[model samples]
Target: MQTASGDTQSRLPDTIVDESALDELLSRPSPALQSFIKTVSSPLVILGIGGKMGPSLAALALRAAQAADHPLEVIGVSRFKGDGARPWLEKHGVKTISCDLLDAEAVTRLPEAKDVIYLAGLKFGTAQNPSATWALNTLAPARVCERYSRSRIVALSTGNVYARNEVSRGGSIETDPLTPLGEYANAAVARERIFEFHSRRNGTSVALLRLFYAVELRYGVLVDIARKVHAGEPISLATGSFTCIWQRDANEMILSALALAASPPAVFNLCRPEIFSIRQVATRFGELMDRPPRFMAVETGLDLLGNPKKVCDALGQPPVTLETMLRWIAHWVTTGGRNLGKPTHFEVRDGNY
Candidate 1:
């Protein structure tokens, strides 16, 4: 991949997006989703339906249920089903169960459903605590999938499983060989492999959505850059190109997978059609805020990224454009999104969960 000489400062072209565009993207379901909805014989159970992006996914599943004309008992599974999400799910009359999937008792209690969305996993910088990441992020799902291999499973994976950029031009693909650069991603790779192994042995249908960055109320990577620039701190960079998708549209793609998972062990790259360098993302924030970004350049490789191919084909389109989604985030930040709160990951130094 040839980059310009002043690559760090070479910003990608700008884009403008509107609310109508957002609505339109959310309206359609991916082919994979349609397949799951049309053919799966049971209700859909989505684990991690209570985490960062869970609320949006839960809402999408309910809407998909109504649109597909299928009887979907959409259940939200989380360790502590928070109240913030309850309002949205309750509005849709979505069901929820509070339990840690890691608990044998909890796994046993999960209601039988033909289509399952395994959304539960540890997210974020886990290089410091490899074991804990391996346990919750990798081991738990492996166990749960084994417990319910008969169900069609749409297990969540990460773009992190792919090799870091320099090798990936646009990004990674479904059959791309994996190189786990960090502990967090290694566990994630392990999680996906567990499903593959089980599916091979038990004939369970599975699809691994290799998710890249998905954004909603909170500041995603762009906002992270903005916050640093906003507060007048220097933004750090490691020459990397990444992809992001709006949560609303991204959720629709994942739910679509449950319906698409009728086949055994399918892997799809979940990301927007657009690819932008880390610096370009920062510049967008600067553009929206009408300020110049404060940034320092360096070379970086940990690109948990993708180019949306499988998702587009399966979900009927690519994830929302980077600029459109970033615009939404900029608006939220300007109006004060008010920190919706995030999960606490293990400290990098503490090799504990």
Candidate 2:
């Protein structure tokens, strides 16, 4: 498969042997990203840098800056409660500031930056403690938007904000309704609303990216399916189709999205344009891992999917192909590679989690 940039799938490594290699792969900046970094101003502040995608994202921005010789200072802010992401970011030359975004005063103390990437949001434990999820999703954005009222902010939202769409209808577009099920999804909508409100009121330039899923070798929809196949576990097909982009591609586009920020916040669905079938992907993982995948549920034909045409038109289609991702994930699973133990729960049809 050829990427939007004309690069072929053969350029990707056959197998990521370990975490070191995986980190390097995820943080590697593309040529387009390097050029984009040149246009970004110094002191790029990335909020919630302790999350799964945050460390590598901060590193990717720093790497792009280095490649472009832009002399950029990448600052990552998060509640660094012995998460180890702080040290990893520090090792990558990203300045780390420990701050709880829920505290408005601390948010004000954050260093000024013309460009900010908001990654702070809670999702996993929403079922148990919906209040925390709501507070984090709603409060953090309010504080950050207030603190960075004049900055260009690229906030990461989720595809969960939209209800599941018919498989034949492609996927949900940006203008689709935000009527989703479950507390987590609703909270995500609130996060976007807060950013939109602040942008409109303060004339803040903001870009809200509704990302479907970002897959790397460790933990994602692909890894979930691959591990199920490798472990002889049943792969659920209740949620038939899904969408994902390589983490590197997602992070690069996220950084590039700073250019898309505008008053009232420009919205874009972030994912590969192609919709992936759960059965097809699981079966392919079975083939790659030399294990037959077990099936449990039937396909509902409705899923939480996103169409990336708008973002792809703005920033080129993600370079990593589904086949490449499947191959890499299967290899990692069979080799007993370490996983984050966090399942994407992509099969959930009710938006729970």
Candidate with best lDDT? 2
What TM-score against the true fold does each predicted structure earn? 0.81, 0.97
Off by over 4 Å in 2: 1-4, 7-10
Task: Give all candidates' CA lDDT scores.
Answer: 0.65, 0.90
Model 2 root mean square deviation, Cα atoms: 1.8
Candidate 2, residues 1-353, lDDT tens digits: the string is 11245442336688889999999989888777777888788899999989999999999999988988899999999999997898899999999999999898888999999999999999998888999999999998999999999999999999999998899999999999899999999999999999999999999999999999999998999999888899899987888889999998898889999999999889999999999998999889888888998998898888888999999988887888899898889888888899998899887766667
lDDT of 1 at 107: 80
* Tens digit of per-residue lDDT, candidate 1, span 96-169: 77778778777887888777888888855465666666788766776777678888888888877876655246
Per-structure clash totals for the candidates: 6, 0
- Stretches off by above 4 angstroms in model 1 are 1-42, 67-69, 81-88, 124-129, 262-264, 299-302, 341-353
Using TM-score, give the best candidate's number.
Answer: 2
lDDT of 1 at 35: 40
